[model samples]
Target: MGDQKGEVVGGLLDSVRDVAGLPECRGICKIMYGNLVRRIKLLSPLFEELKDGRQELGEEELKGLELLKRAFNSAKVVLISVNQGSKLYQAFHWDKVALKFHQVTEQIEEALSQVPYEKFDIPQEVREQIELVHAQFKRAKLKVETGDIQLMMDLNVAQIEGVDPAVLKRLSKKLQLMTINDQNKEGRAIHELAIASGNHGDKIFEMSSLLRKFKDCTHQDSLEFDSDEGERSPLKHRSPVIPDDFRCPISLELMKDPVIVSTGQTYERSSIQKWLAAGHHTCPKTQQTLLQTTLTPNYVLKSLITLWCDSNGVELPKKQGSCQSKKPGRESGAVDCDRTAIDVLLKKLADGKPDQQRAAAGELRLLAKRNADNRICIADAGAIPLLVELLSSSDPRTQEHAVTALLNLSINESNKGKIVNAGAIPDIVDVLKKGSMEARENAAATLFSLSVIDENKVAIGAAGAIPALVSLLDEGSPRGKKDAATAIFNLSIYQGNKARAIKAGIIGPVMGLLRDAGGGMVDEALAILAILANHAEGKAAIGLARPIPILVEVARTGSPRNRENAASVLWSLCSGDLEQLKEAREIGAEDILKELLECGTDRAKRKAGTLLELFQRLDAPSPSSLEQKSDA
Candidate 1:
């Protein structure tokens, strides 16, 4: 028993540091060794009997030895868990952690193989505990291997797909994957093993409490905060009551990483991240199930809190949330931070299985939305093609998520070329025709962003996206209409695209928008009509539709920008065309133009003068025509 204690049990505890280069696990080794040494010191006069050539242990000694071995072995299991978990602070090393899990499980299985309880007739309860540890290990290993596959089966909504090799290579850089379920399971298994060991179970590791030790531990990258009063420093003084809006409902403390879930409830980013990381698909406060996990940073709320802190002398929350870019004007550090993270997420989005890909899509969308820099990094990492591929996915929800991501990326002007080169226009066009209403709206919005480039405008125009755009303007929701109008305005900048837009019959519907459009939509709708009216085909459509009355009213009452657009379209219609002049006169445009000329700015007055001058020239009768009318 003494030799077993010195060699096998001691060897197991010492091997932990050697097996992994984790600095976090080093402290636990000392605690495990101390526990072993204290247990060993309880025995006395053992060496004297062994030196006298006593061949076997007495009954009491043998039972004590079995108990000691079990204690050391159980302590070894706890140390292994601490080893695994301390490195699990960030998801960046999950692959490494997974390998460690395999090795540690193998190590425990080997150690458990040494306990010859059946041959030695150890106590039944102790034997049962050891058996229980083995069973728990098996259960944990099984869970790690199969959890992902099961999750995929549960969430997979379409046939398996094969990704393009070139696209895959572009995005296949290994990144830290988020693996909450597996990590939580591993922690649980070790905690259960420690409990079954009878004595070692109550000891807590450094940050996470095993069932008894790690209760209510909050983990951050490279740091952990203990919520328990006994675990933390003694409270010196109570602070002021934090504003209810400032506090996260999940943590009920100050929101450090303040993020808003789909339900519009705000929680600390870390708390919500853990909730999502644990694969729960509902809000903690409302219990309303979430369809998509998009945690937008509540930057306004954060700003208010910062201002409140400065004004009241209360402490500001730590700058832990991804959105709270603490250092402004330091572009290099921000870009460097974003580049590595975007690479990791892109890799996961490109190469991971269905559930992982979906999760990565949702996460990438959220991150890209946080700031312009993140979007630039995501686009530069060749995320465009992978997102384009996801856009073609058969799953409706996946399609919307992919569309949302593409829309986010397309906001960066540089990503347009990548998306266009990948021929995303075709898929996006398909989405406009067939996707869900939200997907359709997002697709149209993406098209608006993409068509801002002159080259992409021609490409989208060639892809026959104009008809779908026109249809959206006619029948889509309010936001969809605005997006479509913006896209048409961008597309109609070129003369050929104008012809294409006119061919799609955009003039009448666009005029309908001009009549009642509010907010930014008013300007965009007016611009499309003005561009269309410059062409002969479009002028006839607008003249026949007879929106001159609406134009006259808008030129008089709309915002300055809208008035300018309205005046320009009217100028195109009325200049040198007697028929258009007649339409303008019948709609009382002359009087409105006269009023605008008196009160309008230089641009509006210039346009009104041009219209009024054309009306004067068209109204003047020729001398020969007047003489002929007098003779008759």
Candidate 2:
């Protein structure tokens, strides 16, 4: 029976070993489940204490224990099956279980390597318990495989159990070193990879190209900025090159219409001349710089001289060659030096002081010449009434100079009426009424100068001056008649003087001069006829007084100039009454029309045609009268 029981035990052990050697059995269950539960009964006390205390395991620990319990239960079932006397199942069961025990030991080592000892506080008692479990598992693994119970007893479970603190510290330092070393390795690997691929060279080339483009753009931008800055600078700082002294002093602009001053100095430009001539030689406020001897003739002054000479029908002097000189101041007195001496003496008479005035006047009378400025100077000196008083001088020379100066002074229309009102006209008329032919001619010329003013025309007409003027037109010299006819023409231009001319019986002398057809009296006659035609009452009086018939006769038989002037007068008369149209046409005005057509301007032709048409329209019978004549 002892022999039989040993065999049974051996068989049971063999079966348990076979089941534990399966490939899936691991951890404590693979190594120690048979011995701890059945052979040694080592887990009995732990199971009893856990049941009594109701000790709870952590979730991770419980998961590990549950895996162990499942493995043990699977081993138990496989052991039972092997013990059912299946030889093939029992054949490699011990080797298989031994390999599984080694696998479980490796798993335990791997689990301990990964476990965080920092999260747990294991007591000594628990540590010892775990050590006993490890020892039991290791001993059972050896005994089942080799059938060596003694080797099972030699197993050092404590060595396989919990970690030593020193070992744990070494592991922590190793892990930290590994982590830092990994970071350094990664950095070195990336740098080497960049160099190997030529990517770093490409980045350098791209940066260099970008820098060159940026420099070019900046250079262009700087040039544009400088150009704009220059454009924005001010223009006032740029100086004009005109000379300062060239500017005018009076207008402060440029010089125009300059004149000459007669003090004692000269200037380069004419501004000073104008200033001095206007009585501004010394500035009105500053009173400096006496401007004189400057010659700047204005364009208007030159134009006035040309017009005066042309209108007077006088010939200007030709340019003379330089005279061959005799020795200074030595001359034969036989040459008639009157012309040169007269010019010099006239200048002195015009501008000389009062002491030299009479000597200059005597020289002017000897040459029968006068200067216009002498009259201006005398008038400026308030000597006009004195000159008028001298008109009655017994000396013909004094009377001639006085009348010439008065005539020149009265050339201005304002001064003409003034002199006439100052009781000069009656004196002037007495000369024309009674003096010698030379006196009459001078008086007539003076009256002609005065008659240009409208007020003088009326005044002289009222003073009974026209009859004396007309008497000269018949009996006086050609110059006297010219002057007298001019006076008559001027007086006749006025409506008031037209009646005065007729009442003074001066129109008869004017017509007599026109009848002579000499001495250029035609213009004066046509002018008187025009003035008469313009006045309605004057036209009627002229027609009743027989002047109209004389005008009609001139229009019929006179020269073309006379006929044109007569037709113009008739046109003016026609404006007053259409009845003048018949009288004008009856005087052979159709000949005037034919003459106008042959020679007249377009305007004159049109005007004459219109007048002829008006005359014909008036001559035709009226429509109402024609109806009455047809009934008769």
Candidate 3:
């Protein structure tokens, strides 16, 4: 309300100041985010409109907008950089933090490359406004570029008191003898001040407070020095922190079966294996071809990591193998996918040579993919374990074929138990986490089918399936999104998994899909939302997703199930809440619901009738319903 348009850039710089001052402690990055995300949120619509309407603007204005666009994009990259580092810091790694910084700077450079500055023809009043905003923006940019990191090792506080030249030299030597571990924030601040002011034993708390306000620091992940004990003190309460370089760049995970590449970069063997197996022969960092195709075992790094984990009593991540070839299976002519052919493929997959196994897996994959009867045929042939074994193969193509075949096979209720019993959950989770996009979709869909078995639900949750599925809903191909939503819908049937699904940020994407999605996906997404909306968290998340109008539109015009689901979801959200009922009225939802009540099935008719009765009772039009009206 207070000059939002005028304060856009100014607000950005102020937000940066607040964000930069936040401590680089675990969970603090979450606090540092929303500022930039909010700025981008405000500017996005304005930027889009300007870009789409250059014909309505003068060339100079268009140019100004372009420069502003570059600035905004650069800020977004910086935000992403901070976001990546936040995730890294939460794990207590600093090397990746440095790498994230380098990558963000590169992105910023690319973002601003198209900035036009030659003879800009903006008016003086507008130009004055820009210069005024630019002054603070430039300073903030400079501060970020030349970040203020005062590492305690480099801080020479002994000479800061304006002490004497000769006797003070001896004094400095003696002062340096009283050492503090730089990693101890309180101790470092105490040392800095005692060396500077020369007489304050009680100043540790005061200085630590100041340091927290003025600086962002990496707190030791699990270890800290006991401040009173001077010599090699161990933390009384905390565990030991891992070394910064222990994680693979590709996976951002701890190295297991560490391997050094031709580029002299060490990665978790499985990560680099997956990379190489995905068909990129070049180094991920240097882009140089690994002509020799060798990965030397980094035994020293592995030993050190092992020693650290052993000393700290921390369990290491599971050791996983490298990836396989990415080449897809050849689509052959239609096969007579009867019971005999299915048995032949299953035997070959189970007992044939590697080449024969791969071919059989691919053919079974194709047969399963062809139709439901073939899936039943393959299931009847007892192919679950063979297909599950192929899922663990190094060849990505083999893994994809195996997982997809398992998914197709899992469509049969009898095959699901066999799939789960054959130890398919972990391997399926692995594919969901790291497979090709297509493989990931198949894995998600397969997990949904397998989870239908009551026993397998716990296994899927334990295997960490929710986030991976949510990611697909957030950003995936159309088919992938549909499957991911269906997966969430299936998984949410268990009460414990609902909180996990909602916490993974599922509501927003599912609602976003509802805005444009079609067919069974809309039905699937709504079914999930209906359950989510029953809980307080679900209702709040649905309100935040802002899809009531879209739901209203769907209620007015969609398939029977969609109309019923939409009407029911709206009725759930509005029931026992007058404000929500008022919103329903304002969005033309009353009219839609009346129409739905008159024309819809019994379930939709009942919900619409109830929603309308509530709206008629409440006179206040809700804010969301007003927005929905304008939106519709």
* Most accurate candidate by lDDT: 1
Off by over 4 Å in 2: 1-370, 394-397, 409-422, 544-563, 572-587, 594-610, 629-632
> Taking the tens digit of each residue's C-alpha lDDT, what string does model 3 give over 472-568?
8877787787778767766776777888888888887787667656433566677788878877778878876666788888898787767888888
lDDT of 2 by residue, 1-632 (tens): 33433332333344435444543322222334344334223333333333334234455544443344334434454434323321211221345545554455444433333323223345456445645655544544333533322223212221233434343233222212123233233223322222122112223222222222222333344555656778675432332221223223222222223343343222323334323332222332122223333464555644554454455554432322222243222233313234445455555555665434554554333222222233333344445565566567666656666666566555433456567766898888877787777877878777766765556767777777777876787798776777776677667766777777666666567666666675566766676666566666556655554444555666566655555566666666665566566776666776666667567534346556666777778769999999999999
Whole-structure CA lDDT of model 3: 0.60
Candidate 1 lDDT tens digits, 517-580: 5543566677678778888888877777777778888887887656777898889877767777
Pairs of colliding residues, candidate 2: 21-96, 21-97
Output the TM-score of candidate 3.
Answer: 0.43
Q: Estimate each model's TM-score.
A: 0.47, 0.40, 0.43
Report the CA-based lDDT of candidate 1 relative to the real structure.
0.61
Q: How many clashing residue pairs are found in candidate 1? A: 3
Root-mean-square deviation of candidate 1:
22.5
| Candidate 3 wrongly placed segments (more than 4 Å) | 1-353, 369-382, 517-521, 619-632
**TM match of model 1 to true structure:** 0.47
Q: Candidate 3: deviation at residue 444, Å?
A: 1.9
* Decreasing TM-score order of the candidates: 1, 3, 2
